[model samples]
Target: MGETIGYARVSTSGQKIETQALRLQEHGCSKVFQETYTGGSTTGRKALLGLLEYVREGDSVVVTKLDRLARSAMDLGQIASTLEDKKVDLVVLDQKIDTSSPAGKLMFNLIGAFAEFERDLIRERVQEGVNKAKEKGVQFGRKAKLTKQQLESLRNDFAEGELSKGQLAEKYGLSRSSVYRLVKSEH
Candidate 1:
């Protein structure tokens, strides 16, 4: 039989992974890889990459929770697929997910679908909220670069041909496109 390898992760330095490491050790994990990096970010994930390279067939990967392994269902699915390809088992302690059984595989699939659906709903709600706020005249994003008086002067300068769009942009410390947009708004 192969050994059980554990992985523990915490999102920030302020958080501790000691609890998770202890849990994995108690749960029969001989080796544990711990890291303090955001699960969503793949860059600089040295521990995870090392674990993936080190595991072999008959070895099982254990984690305190599914979120400790991945940020999204798509990412989870991809990681699960890689483990399956190498004939390695995945055990998520908190979620009670073990890929060694048929039922576990089914549950993982369902969870992935639900996760994706939840993200989509959140995005839709946010977009709707932004639209409603716009209707209420609540502007979002950065404030305008040029105020009303400056825009009026810019329009006058452009109309009088005293300066070109490029010259106006340089004088006002704005982009040429901004100068064009301000001039167009007057007509």
Candidate 2:
């Protein structure tokens, strides 16, 4: 028999990992690693990396949910492969996936496929909504930081050559690149 390890993650500082930790503990996790950070990429997941490194043969890595461990199906596959290579088991409580058995592996693959399908459907729906919004004359993304009057003033200032680009940027609380763009644009 080996130790049972648990991992918990919350995307932002505002969210708490206590509930996850408690669940893992109740589920017989001898050790739990918790972190608050975005799972957008695995590059900066220190706690997860630590747990992976610390696990040994016969150990089990547990999570409250499958999504809590990896951002994408590919990521989950890689992590599962690593755990398998290390002779460690993966247990996702919510999904009831325990990679210690043949049936579990089959279920995991099926669930991954379904998750990818769901994501593709969501992306298609979002694109359709965005296209419809564009047809209705809706705008997206952040509004320009500089106002039309400020842009015009910057154009005049640049034409008069009263202030340098840096000075103008400082005066208007804008970046030098923004000032340059405003000055260069046709009035």
Pull out the clashing pairs in model 1: none
Q: Candidate 1 residues 76-134, lDDT tens each?
A: 78888889998999998888989899999988777767766776798799999999999
Model 2 lDDT at residue 110: 79
- Residue-level lDDT of model 2, residues 58-102, one tens digit each, is 999999987788766787787888899999998989999998999
lDDT of 2: 0.88
**TM-score of candidate 2 versus the correct structure, residues matched by position:** 0.87
Q: List the candidate 1 regions with Cα displacement exceeding 4 Å.
A: 10-18, 35-46, 144-146, 150-187
Clashing pairs in 2: none
After superposition, the stretches of candidate 2 with alpha carbons farther than 4 Å from their true spots are: 185-187
